[model samples]
Each structure stands twice: as structure tokens, then as C-alpha cells.
Target: MNTLGVTLVLGLLLGVWAQTNIERPQCDSPEAEEAALVAQDYLNAEHTQGYKFALNRIEDIKIYTKPDGDKTYKLEVELLETDCHVLDPTPLVNCTVRPKMMTAVEGDCDVVLKRVGGVLTVTAFKCKTEESTEDICLGCSTLLPLNDTTALDFVHKSLASFNNFNENVTYAVFEVGRMSSQVVSGGLVYLAEYVVVEANCTEDPCVPLNDAMAARGICTAKGSSIAHSVNCQMFLTMMPVIDANVVDVNSTVAVTNSTSAVAPALPPMVHVHTGSLSPKLGLRYHKLTTLHNPELSGLLSAESTESDEVVPVAPGVANSTAPADAGSDSSNSAEVPVVVKKRDVPIVPVVPAPAVVDPIAVVPVCPGRKRFF
Candidate 1:
């Protein structure tokens, strides 16, 4: 064989040996933990809706060191749903995992992180959640995740059709609890069970439901493109003129077609007493913790009300109300007294400017990362 041919073969064998000998990092290592935490934070920040998630466990970790001193880490992380919603702004440390009785949701994510110059950043991540199997029928209907786009579309269309059929009250979709799909001869049939809150107006462009209102109902819809049907039972809260306890007025609306019906009497204004609201409403009113930067907290608290007024003082002198030349011995050695004038200005608290954060840098997906969804 020629010398060139032997050299090429030797180089190929060395490359294969190096590739096979790559080391896998421990899942509990510091680098792996840091990458997982970064990926979790990115997911929480990017997920604008639904409940927030907390890291349950790290499944796998792989680290690849580059020739330029950079390292890429791929992590498979499992996350559990927390009681706090995404809009609560509560720190993950304070959030508790939802119990299984409450239909807890869990997800697995494939995250890729790259460290350059000792700084780690998440490049790409994708998560898939397990669908609920409670009451799922075999070969009849398939349950889908609550975040599925197609199920959500079906929910919106069903709600719109419901509002059009019922002329008594305009209901808006508050939350979609469960959904399932079935294959029929005509087309696909979608079934959605959702909660609806009473909207302020009674038309297509009605105002959104008020947070303080306790009037809500449950609805179940089943249909396809050919036809749809919705049945809703709403409980309206009513405050009696003499009774102390609130009363619930029940109303039912059933529609099998999209045809409009006669308008019924509007329900009275709902007056819910304190501590009697629904659990879902209580979740919406959770007290959010204020998150402040530790480095800027002192500056923010030390802000002076007289920021616009500047009082220049001498380098080694204390503030005083005495005359500028009161303690003068010689004409050249006069003591200057800094007078602080008191004004009757109202002290207004100043709001601190929002801190600017650098955007996360993203790079191409690493070859070591594989999605397991």
C-alpha cells in the first residue's frame, strides 16, 4: 500500500477511537445541575400561560468539550407542575408540587446548553407532557394534552357556537379542563369539557368577565365540522335582601344547533361574600412575591426625595445652618457654614427604573442532544 493510503487509514481509526471513548458526565455533577437549572428558568420565562413547573429530576446528562475550551451540555430533565401559575411571578423555591389528586401534570424536556468563556446559556429546548388517562376509553376516544393546539381550536369554536345559540347570556371560556378526539365517518369529532364565566356584555364583542364575579358554569361540547352540540349549567350567585348567606340560582341552556333562540331574563348581579369564592378564583388572587436584584436593592431604598435639588458641600465640611463666614478668624481663613434650608415639600416615593437584562444567546443544536418526546 502507498504511504498516503496507510496514513489515511490510521487517521480514520484514531478518529473512531476518540469518538467511542467520549466520557459521559454524572447527572448530579455541578455542570449538569447548572445546565438543568438554566434550562428550567428559560422554560418558565418562555411559558406565558398555564401553571409553572418545577424541576422534578434530571434523567440524563452529556457533556462535550470543544478544542476552543468551550463545553456543550445536553440534559434530559423531568418537571412537575406547581401550584403557582405562570402569572404569579413567585419564585420556584417557594412553589409546591401539585398533588396527584388534583390531576397533576408532568413533562420531560430535552435541553441543550453551551458554556463559552465560563458563561452558560441555553440554546434550544423542547418539552412534551403526558396526557391524562383518567376515564379514557379504548378505541373510542383519544385523550390529548391540555396544551394541544388542535384541541384548543375545537374548544374556541365550540364556545363560539354555544354563545350564538344561547341568547340569554354571553359566556366566555375561562378554562378548558379535558378534551378528547374520535374518528368518525364524516370527519374527526372533538369533545371538550370546559368552564365558562359570565361575560359583562351579551354580544360577540362583549367585555371580558370580571375577576370579582363569581358567576360561572360548566359546559360539555361534542361535535365535528358537520354539526355540534353544547349543554351548559350555570350557577348564578344572588344576594338576598334579608339573608346573610348567599344563594345560588341555577340556570340551564342546551343547544343542539347554531340557530338563535329567544332571549331570557338577565341574571341578577352576583354578590359573593369573602372567603366563599371558588378555589380557581383563589388561585388567581395569589399573593405574588416581589423579586428585586440584591445588588440594586440598597440603591433603590436609598433614593432621596430631594433628588432634583443639589446641595454642594465642601470636601471636609459638615452641613450646618450657621453663616458662611461666622467663625472666621482671619479674612483668608473664614469658616464657611453650609446652611440646609427646610422646605414644606411633600415627600414622594420614587419608583426605581427597571433593570436591563441581556438576552440569552442561542447557538446551533449540538449533535449530542437527542429529543425523546
Candidate 2:
């Protein structure tokens, strides 16, 4: 090995670890005023138990970024609780009451609101008087469950593209980041960070040396459902604004379990001429077809007849093959020559619903009523 070459390769591998964690330095307050405006919007428009709360004062504000480089803010604030009631004597009109204000002075209870990009929303909140830590502090509360969601299914089940993809694919490594939601079309679209570390190819039963060298895959998902996913690269370019689930953002990649597999692992970000490659996820970006090439055949055939290594497949769907050009969105009119076959996998479970945010607009108490005074 070239001494200079070896030294340079070592530098490349360590560069990725340089990415920032949300804990390093915390902001004393919100960075942009827009965050507060967004916060206020959350409260004035927030309706609970037939009561709408008005923003009183902001208790505290902190800002941080997610692993995917998107910024979000945490705001602790007070709200004035108000409820509407039918006046006993008046049939056509209703009167609003501030019960929390009637007899006793209402001490502010802390409610945290998150503002990311232009979509402002709320998550489950509890006030904490204790000085906050990176993982437990109220500042990090919005980012709770710092662990990856376990055994979740990939949003997209089928792979269609110019890249001849292998059915029953397995990943050497898989990971997802914190969950975040955005407003799109008429509903909230939730997303998470996604990455695939090592993978197999369509042409060769095992990943090839060069393709695995370039075996980049970061796919994510969209839709109100957990059962759908799209490739990140393809999703970014083709999917509409509402988000067909970010393609690579939350990709559904299956992991490889067989040890007799011949596929070479994709090299780590930092190159080491070591005997084996240490696979890392969420680094490179390989196209759907890059993992695929139409030229190779008999890729799925395993050399060892004694052992069984399972490939990942969408639940309840038949295993099948398609052309690289047939990628994700061929017109329904196009003729797909392959027969879809069923391979029984575990059924997909229902994903928890996306958290609710304050309404974008407030509805009126009466047909024409806008204010109390």
C-alpha cells in the first residue's frame, strides 16, 4: 500500500463522524422571531376540550438541529384557557367562560411547541423544573425516544427501476432518525431519517466490488400510512410537495442474514485496507438501478444448499422482478411482463398516527362572532 495513499484514505473515513450531535451547545433562546410567531399561532389556534387557549407569555425558548440538518425549536409557554357555553337564558347565543381565571389566579402550566421549517406543531409535553440534560431535558423532550423504532416495516414494498434489483434483499446495517412531521396537501406528512449501510445487487446474487463500493442507499417514506416508502433520491425529484414520503428519508430496506453470501460489503466512508469492511449506514447515495444491472443472471442462486439466509421482502406480497426502466412510477398503461409471486413475511403493524399540531386557522365560536369584547 502506498504510505501517502494509506494516510489519505484514513482521513476520508473519519470525516463523517464530524457531524454534529444535538447536545454539543444549546441555544439560550430561539434564534429567529418567526419561531415565536409560529409558537403564538399554535396557541391561539389550539382548541382542547371545547376550550381554546390564548398565548400568555413565553417561559423559555431553545433551538437545535436534527441529524438531517433541519432546525427545530422548543418553546415553553403559558396559555389562557377559555371554554364556550350556552347562556341559560339565551338560545341563539353562547357565552364563553374563563373558569381557570374566575376564582383563582391560574399559574402558568408549561406546554412545549415545536416549530420546524414552516410547519409549526405540538407534541406531548410535561413541565420540568429540574435542569435539563441532553436526553431528558425539556429542551430534548420533543426528541424523545432517541432510539430507533424497532422492527418497523419499510414504507415502500416494491422496487421498480432501470436498476435490475434483487428480490429478497438484505441489509448489513439499517437505521432511522427521529420522527418529524410537516403539513402537506390537506394533512400532516411525517418523516424520519433513513439509511442503508451494506446491500446486495440485482445483477449478481451478491453485491459487486464496484457497485458495493458505490452502494449508496438513503430512502424514506411519506403518506399517512406506515406501509408506504419511496427511495430518497427518486422521491426528491419526482414526488409532489405533499411528500410521497421522502424516498431515502425513511427507506424500507431488508437486511441480509446469510453468511455464505458472496457479495462484497460497501466500503466504509473512511477507507481501511483491512481484510473486512466495517459497514456504515446513511452515508452514500446509490440510485435504484445502481444496485441493479440487467446484465447479470443467476444472482439469487445461493452456492450453499445447506444453510438458509432470508432476504427482506414486503409483507404479504409475492417476490417478483422488473426492468430498471420500470422504476417506481411507470404508467399503469405500461405492460409489466413479470408475474408477481407471494412470499409470506410478517404482516405490517399499524404505525402510530402523526402527532397533532395547532390548527393552521381558528374556527369561529359563532357564525359571525370573532371577538368577546
Candidate 3:
């Protein structure tokens, strides 16, 4: 082929390669996604009882992407309650300004960003009454006291802890897989995207709230970090679905209502023994070996013989019963003698037993059996 033909073929191949490599951006900017998340958060904030008047107003949308690096955008949101509300302005709610971070999900092409509220609460309505019921409750304290940076830090720490889990355990695998896949990598990424979008959704401040159900804080204990709080609220709560076999009325009530009642007083104590009881102590147990066990009862009639009883000797006393010195009287028999002889008894030598060694007996060699190595 001619040189010009070769060059044309090479040029065509290069163009195809370039076209395949090109990666079109999914959204106009990462900031747009963050705006959406802030908006959703604001809507959720309105549903909480005291913070019913809280609303989010997007102040600015800024997109930043490092050249050939992950794209990030910041959504500056203003969170405030209207004149009708009386909730204290916390760092999370009733505050005038808040910011949420958003990043593009690495692979997904859709411009839509997914978000998860760091703060979450669930409540159940009981006949739409003003009275409180556990059925309609607020929860998800895992999200409390955390902002963008702290939330991300917590997520990273969780991922690290999962990575350290042992692979041999079945439960560890399940835990690690669930956290790393669902919550850590996938859920967190999507959540960050949602935060960005929600933060930019609207410019209206203090979105009106008709009536709210409850308010709550979400606090999660991540690895090595102290529990953090995320302020949130909810309009409805979901009840846990329990199986019939798993629900035990009596036992479960005891566990759930530990603080329900005060305990009764204990009975008074009585002293029985007057003299030294010695606690009837030691490992020597008195056995009732016969039908009428007299040994167990220490009590006896006044005429009972005490002659055969042995008395314990005091420390450092000579106990020999040999006849006392010639001048000693009968009363001196009860006293220990200090003039006892101190004799050194001769030591008996221990003879060494003979060591039995095995006899070296020679066996008769078989004819023609030996061979040279």
C-alpha cells in the first residue's frame, strides 16, 4: 500500500479510540445536585413539631471539579424558622445558614442525585389525637450532631472498621458486605449527591408548615468517635414487624418495663448464736451417717463425759505427758513445762536404690544375612 493510504488508516483508528474514551458529564454542575438535597432536608425539617416553621433557602450554587479528579459542589443553604415558631435555633435546625456537600456518583450517568438524611425520624399516628403514643414515635438518632465533614469522616471510619473484620466469621462477612456495599460506598455516595441537590432546590426561606407530628435527634456511634447528633423530625412512625413465636408477653414486658415499679423491702435479720460460732467453717462436713445422727448435735447433758476430749495446745508449748519433776504438785500438771530437754535426733540416711540398666545380650547371626553397605 502507498504511504498516504497507511496514514489514513492510522488516523481513522485514533479517532475511534478518542470517541470511545470521551466521558460526558451527567449534570451541568455538582452544585445542582447538592441544591436538590438541601431542598428535601428543608421539607423534612418542616414536619417536626417545634421546627414546623423551619425552611431552607438556597443562597448560591458553586461547582468545583479538580482537573481529572472527582467533582465536588457546595450548596450554601439558609435554614430558619418563621415568626410563628418557638423552637431554639440549634446548629442543625432553626439556624440561619447551613451547607451540604455533593459529589458525582462515579459510574452512574443519570443527572439525578440520590440523598439520605443524616437525621431521620419515624412516627405513627394514633387516631389523629393530640395525646402521645409509642406507636407514633420519632427515632433514628444515628444522624445527630453531624455536619458534612463530620458525616463523611464517620462514614470513612465505618468503612475502615469493616475492613478490619475477620473473614472467617459468617456474621462478619454479612456485616462487612452490608455496610461496605449498601451504606458505606453506595448509600453514602448517593446521599452526598442528594445533599447537594436539596441544598439548591429553592430560594424561598421559611417554607410554611401546616401541622407537624414530632421532632427528634439522630445520634450514631461510629468507630473511635464519640456519638454525634443530627437533629430531625418526622410526621409518622413505622412499627416493628414481630413474628408470633418471637413475642413473649411476660418476659418481654419485664425487659421493656424495667423501671416501671419500685421493689419491695427485704425482711429483717436475726442473730441466733451467743458464743463464738466460728461459722461452722472449713471443708470438714458433719455427715448424718445413721438414722439417729447424734454427732451432728453438739449439745449434751451436764453429766456427759468430757474425759476423752483432746484440748488444743497453745503455740510454742511442750506437750510431753511424762511425770513432772519430783516437787511438782497435781495443779502444776495442767501447766506447760518450760524446762523440757531440746535433743537433736540423728538423721536417717536414705540409701540410693540400684539403677536397673538393660542387659546387652548378643543374638546369633543368621547365615548369609549380613550385607555390606
Candidate 4:
């Protein structure tokens, strides 16, 4: 081939065309996607109790994407209250700022996609024309989002706190995901993205909700962090779902209240034991044992014979009974001498032994290795 032909072949190889290859789509700028998110968040903010007000024109949108993938956008939007009952806000069709007229009004809006609690949350900064000072929109709060940055020193102080089971937990940058100047709550509540850096997993199936939340692959502690708070086995017979803090009346209350008129009060109530007494129709349970049994009253009082008393005879003491003197007076004929060793006397009250309910009548004999002895 000629030099010109060689050049042509090289050109075709370098120039990948539409027919020879798949069409390459232009990579979307981070700013453009963030603008859409901002507009959607604006609609959500306009949502009221019964109906959600929507906006079509999100005007003059300016999107800013940070290094951490957080996004912020500012625009002007025109509110349009619709009949739709959708709880979530759909994206605006267009963001065109038209000249102000009687029916149409414009408001400045700040929309942001913030990382919060390991989730991305959309937030908007907007102020009503009535609330704003002149043309400048100060959003909802005068404090501004800069208040969150003020807490940075407090956040650094949290490093001293020992967190996690192994004490290997760390403090990370709690970036503000969403900040609202005005909301249902009067003051500003910064919904922040907590950078909880979980410990690195050295092995598979690592412990859940420990330093390795990544092991569980979830932030919630339903099954991961918390085990059963109450006895699972006791309630497992009837209770199906295990929701935290929710009371299941069927499993807990209906256990002892089959035909009872009202649900019995839960006990044993704290600090309520008054040691009260009852008699007659009022039933009471005495801790009945062999020692306290009413049926075995007769056997407890059986006179203690000399052998029944377990007195240890001391080597120092000598007990002797003298035979009647043959020639002495009748009253002085017999004399008994008792020698008692005196030490620190331990006063002991005599208690009779309660009779056994049933004596072992027969013993089972295990003659060989085949028997369970």
C-alpha cells in the first residue's frame, strides 16, 4: 500500500464511528443531577397536611457539587397547588423564571442533597415573601446553616468518649446532610450524616452491629444490635413480629385473661409489697413445707427421748448415778451427780424435727452396668 493508504487505515482505526461501535453518551455533570434533586425537594417542602403543593418553574438553578458527593442548588420556584394526594414530591417539569404577574409569584429556594445517618436526605432552604426582609431571602432561620460548623469543637470533644463494644470505635466528621431554618419545630435541627467508620472486616460473617456495621450491611439494630429485650421463648408461642417498644396485647395480656372481665394489672408492681394479710374467702398461699405443714402437726410434738437429743458427751464431764445407800434415810437414799463443763454458753432454742411426709419404703437396686443407677 502507498503511504497515503497507510494513513487512511490508521485514521479509521483511531476514529471509532457510530456504525462500527456503540454510541458513547456524554457523561452527565454532577451539577445537572443535583439541580433536579433540588427542585424535587422544593416541591416536598410546599406539601401541606392534606394536599401537597407542586411547582413547575424552578428558575435560575445553580448547582454545586462538593468533593464528598454532597450537593447544593439554588433556584426560584413558582408554587402550584394541585389535587394530587402524593406524599412524595415528583421532580419539576421545567424551571423557567417568568416575569412576575398577579397569579404567578416567585420565591428563592435552596435545595440540598445531604448525607444523613448513612442515608441521602433532600433539604431545601426557602422563605415566604411575607417572611423575607425586602428582596433578600434569609431562608427560615437567621442563625443560618453556619451554626452547625460552630459545633465542630463539640464534635471534636466527642473523640474523648469511648464508644463501641471493643473500645475501638472512632469519631468521624458529622457532615450536615440537611439544614432547615424553618420547619414544624421552631428551632433549627440539622439532620446530619454521621460518619460512623465501622471497623474493617478481617473475616466473613463478622459480628453484627459491633464496630463492623458494614458486616451487617445495615445501620439499624432491629436484629443486629439488640437481641430480644424480653424472654422470646415465653412470648414466641403467640407473638409473631418483633417490633421494638410496641406492646402485643394478644401475647402479653391475653395469657391469663381468657374469660376475665377486665385485663389484669401487670405485676409484680415495684415497691407495692405491704405484707398484708387476708382470711376466709380471701385466698392466701402459705409457704407449706414439712416444717410449716398443718397436716403434720402431731408428729412435731412427739416427746424427745434421750437418744433423740444429739448432745456430744465431753471427755471432761462425768455423769454418775449412785445406788440408794442401804442404811440412809429414804429421802436421802439416792443421789445423782452431774458434772457440767462451763465455757462461753451459746444459748440454743429447742426445735422439734418435723415428721417426714413419706419414708422411703423400698430401694431400687442396680445390679449391673445395664441399669441407670
The lDDT for every candidate, in the order shown, is: 0.49, 0.29, 0.22, 0.25
- After TM-score superposition, what is the CA distance of residue 74 in candidate 4 from its true location, in Å? 3.4
lDDT-best of 1 and 4: 1
Candidate 1 residue-wise lDDT at 209: 72
Please provide TM-scores, in order, for all candidate models, with all chains considered together.
0.40, 0.22, 0.15, 0.20
Candidate 2 per-residue lDDT, tens place, 1-373, comes to: 6999877754543232223122211112333334444544443333211123334454444333434654434334443433221111212123242332121112132222344566655532322111112222221212112132321222222122102122234432233422334555555554443433344443333332334343334444443343334443321232221123223324433322223323233222221111221143321111011111112111121221112432433421211121111211222101122211111122443522233221211221211111221
Task: Pick the winner on lDDT between candidates 1 and 2.
Answer: 1
Off by over 4 Å in 3: 1-36, 39-49, 52-56, 82-373
What ranking of all candidate models by TM-score puts the best one first? 1, 2, 4, 3
Instruction: List the pairs of residues colliding in candidate 4.
Output: 58-95
Residue 247 of model 1 has an lDDT of 16
Candidate 1 lDDT, tens digit per residue, 161-244? 555545556766666555668887867878766666667663435554767554566567777523566666553421211111
Q: Is candidate 3 or candidate 4 better by lDDT?
A: 4
Per-residue lDDT for 36 in model 1? 81
- The predicted structure with the larger lDDT, 1 or 3, is 1
Which residue segments of model 4 deviate by more than 4 Å?
1-34, 66-70, 85-108, 115-120, 129-373
Better of 1 and 3 by TM-score: 1
Candidate 1, 58: how far from true, in Å? 0.6
lDDT tens per residue, model 3, 244-268: 1111112121111123233222112
Q: Which residue ranges in model 1 land beyond 4 Å of their true spot? A: 1-23, 132-205, 208-247, 250-373
Q: What's model 4's overall lDDT? A: 0.25
